[model samples]
Target chain A: MSAATADPGNGTILRAHRVTKAFGGLVAVKEVDLEIPPTSIVSLIGPNGAGKTTFFNVIAGILDPTSGHVEFRGDRMIARPIRTWFEPVVWVTPSVVAGVISVLVYLATANADATALAVLAAIGLLIVMFLAAIVRPRWYLRLLATAGVFRSSRPNDMVKAGMGRTFQNIRLFANMTALENVQVGMHTKMRANAADALLSTPRARAEEKASQARAREFLGIVGLRGRAGELAKNLPYGDQRRLELARALASEPTLLLLDEPTAGMNPRETAQMTQLIDRLRRDLGISILLIEHDMKVVMGISDRIYVLDHGELISQGSPDAVRADPRVIEAYLGKPAS
Target chain B: MRPDIVRVLQPIVIIAVSLVVVWLLLGGTQQFMNFLTLGAIYALIALGYTMVYGIIELINFAHGDLFMFGAFVAMWILTVPLGMTGAVDNPLQLTVILVVVMLPTMIVMGLLGTFIERFAYRPLRHAPRLAPLITAIGVSFILQNVIYSVFGPSPVNVPQVFPLTRFEFLGGRVSFLSLFMVAIAVFLMVLLQLFVGRTRLGRAMRSTAQDREAAELMGVDINQTIAITFFIAAALAGAGGTIQGLYFGSVQFNLGFFVGLKAFTAAVLGGIGNTTGAALGGFVIAFIEVFATQLGYSRWSEVAVFTVLILVLVFRPSGILGQQLGERA
Candidate 1:
């Protein structure tokens, strides 16, 4: 049966068509179809162990789906059955070459014949490997991967593609100051090489100053203006949650995925967080995909709500329609005990 | 006073007290100077261990071996290619040889470090923690054996290029070599601190160390950041190795094994992920060793060092400067 889809006219920023994620014997997410429209807030609500997190993990590039696909702005972010042989070659060739050189050097040293030449040869091989890996010329990587290497896009790639996310449990850089955490979030945007960093070059310093200014601005946007100097770990629970939001925003994403952003928060904090979520979309003009447990928060802010049960979407509609659906209620309350 | 201020000053106070005690026991500034110089060497090596551990939580048993490789690289530059044997009387020539040897040696060792991480450590990054750690031990063995085979399992005498002049200070003589070594080590350490504290990549490193998954979510390339960490740490260790060879006037295949363990202890002692702590720990370890030797307990120096390590671990697992892992809300 064809899934009842969201309005495609509103400009779908993110779409997952029949996405499934399995862990050996357990199918954590099965044939889940979702659509997130631009400049809109959509919520995904499910019972405990209903595969909400697993689905989130798949779209965020943390876990690859067993089948199906995830797209952002019509560009595929994750897909099933990755091209296999190339990845192993990309990861393994250097080691194999190094091992060969090691053995050769060992033999040459033992024989004491042209030891200098052997050592030089090993160094040469190592330099070639270094250059190849660093340059990662796509054609070269692909040519070497003739054996079917499984290549998966990393989380950083997703961020560069204008997707940012927060975790279910707050995962701030505990040791870093709030300002630095946000600066790290701006990592992809900053352009400075190692040499620039070592020499403290003018260009690198200018970039650093710019990034730091932007980081502080992000912190200010999240109502954490003066807390930049505090270590993230030392922040209170509400502030820590806000810091995570600022950090995510630092990446300057077009679409933001917030996983249980209000978990463990008091009612007042939860309300504040809900308002912040709304502000993020309205002010920033970014699409939001939210996975939240607080029904009130989700119902109050989300333009659309999708309810999942046992890894499948049981109901999808506006907040009031989803709230009134019999299937959604049954999924949450076990069919009203017959 | 605020607790933060107390926390920052506590180590300094402890170190100062320890210095006073050492001075009283040794009754000379010369031994104290020697202790500081040796401490600087350990600190350089310890920074490597602490940095890798801070980011990836790997002990990097191969680090000391990398330092040993650095020593050999320095030796090869001087003895084989440059062919400067014994003492170098020409100041300009000595300075030129040092510059030539050190730059290439650090670069080679840095590349070697990057190579080790790419080949030896990167593949096993997602494996069980113990797996990469065991691989680190294996890498250590491989490096040692490689050195042993090439250098014939014996101590290769390094030429003493620095002038043997001594500076008199407060009725005590301090060797110029010791002063130069200490200056270089301090300079590198300061550069490292700045790199880790102020730079963008440095911020990425600290974030990665704190939370790898979260760092990635923020668009930090975890693999690249980790690889860079390994490179920097390995490069520093390489520099330390070169200095070590120059200081003692000898190099050995197994030199890194004992020093590696000691550096690991220093890393642990200083709070594994804390850079300043590692440097402090290195200095502390050196002081203890020198003090033990001066007190005629030279045979028990290793025992004493280990004992302090155990005491620190038992009392403060987070270390002197280390924050308790995951302690914040």
Candidate 2:
């Protein structure tokens, strides 16, 4: 089912420019540049400890790069610019203003009561600030951004912005039912607020029904419809993987990230997973970024491949070209006896 | 029966049997009425403990103090602005007053709870578990001291606004006020259960509690969900505080110390992360407390409660209806 026609947007869907992630003194990923085109399967392959997962995490917004940035569909999703350094100060603006006001009042009025009033006003403003942070009115967020105090995108932000991902270790909501798992993935799409749910309003009820139906459809797409009622942890290994995919798909992301989708699967299961991945992209027009250890699966499905070695991107090309590259071979298997 | 069925049924059966035993021990409707009211209050507080633990895994020691704040807020609302120091003869007027007072108290406490999570817990969310745990204790002390300073270290009387009405029921006199308190408490608990079990946001909360990272990946806002959890939990504590004042007729600044510990014990007894378990734990702890006092062991009531807690911990560390088996990760 690899008959998917290229979409209108020929521009890159995801672009990472010299992304690097460091853990304290240890650099996990270094200056990695990658891109995924619309309706294409791109694979990132590397040996253990080569930072493939770290790169995946940076793309997924699970971690911010020590330097560099990532753009999703032309929107910067991850970055640590100079302005971000002012975020903490922005949060403490109320206290600073309060302190300045009280001090100024004491200096100008020379009256203790005036200073006390100023202090009280400060407390009131602090409360307002706290509430503003919680409610996060759009204007406030815009003001923060304009003041260069914006935060990097969180995982939820990435998911809401049409990116979905699964973990290499299969991090499903294990205690929840498979159906509930998918429903949770549809969290962004559900429009009901807390009040609607608490009151069981008609809008909330209708939205819930619609969401459940759609979630079930996603489960069917992943071939886990019959097991919707079963707890996620109770599912078989292959089924759990499929359920995770279903959960990811429930968000209806334009781009999907699969970390070792067929990690522990037998050959037959591996073939089926590869076919499923192909079908997902072909039928739904969703771009896929895969991190795989299996060579045959990667070569068969990926339109383009980027190989990593020791936290650095070593090679990038079409499957056959990348396979033949000497650097990729050296990265995969240490340089042969000189 | 299938194991799943047994797993589901076991908790219900245990709660039922324990309730029956407690009922048998009460011996009089008056004692039973007291038990129900007290149990309802404990249940409300325990829910806050269990939910915070469920989502962020913090034993918010300050929660009990929040309950104390709730009572004080309600008391201030009643006496200061409303100037209500006696019961209203008209039921309609009384209810209007109750709603006016209770609604504001709940909202105030809810916002306070959200604020606490923001300043106290949210920053330490990624810190070592011990850091937040210690912060919680520190927050608890802060709340207690604030209340102590404001309310003064004395027991203030709340208006007995429900009126003195009693009737014969099951060979003992039952007060109308106690019954009303129980009904309201049970109603809130049921509302909470439905909210958590059926709502989309509730699903987000549960998924978040189970796996915060996965839930975030599914677009569940962790901070918002946790803040809501804190809000709801503290709101219930507010309700409990109001009930405690109205029933007991007086409120003290440190009233939450014993109540909070007892409620925490209940949450652990019922299963720390499970909502139903926490509520069940509340009623069970109430039963044990009432039984001790009823049998003339009021001095040993704390001992009885802790002994039961220890025993439950020793054998079934997951609590009475623990969901540990499902948490294989």
Question: Which candidate achieves the best TM-score against the true structure?
Answer: 2
Worst 10 residues of 2 chain A by lDDT: A1-10
* For model 1 chain A, the run of ten residues with the poorest summed lDDT: A1-10
What lDDT, from 0 to 1, does candidate 1 have? 0.83
Cα interface RMSD of each candidate: 2.6, 2.1
Per-model TM-score, in order, reads 0.88, 0.90
Report the TM-score for the A-chain of model 1: 0.81
Q: Retained native contacts per candidate, as fractions?
A: 0.81, 0.82
lDDT of 2 by residue, A85-183 (tens): 465577678777887989998998899998998888888877776666665533455567667666456677677678898878989888888999999
Candidate 1 structure quality by residue, lDDT tens digits, B32-80: 8878888988999999998998888888999999999999999899888
Classified by CAPRI criteria, candidate 2 counts as medium
Residues A1-338 of candidate 1: C-alpha lDDT, one tens digit per residue: 01112334546888888999899999989999998888999999988888999999888877777889877676665432255334545555665666676667778576545655555665676566556555343344444435445334567767877788888888888878899888888887887867899999999999999888899999999999999999887899999999989988888888899999999999999999999999989999999999975578899999999988888888999999999998988887776755
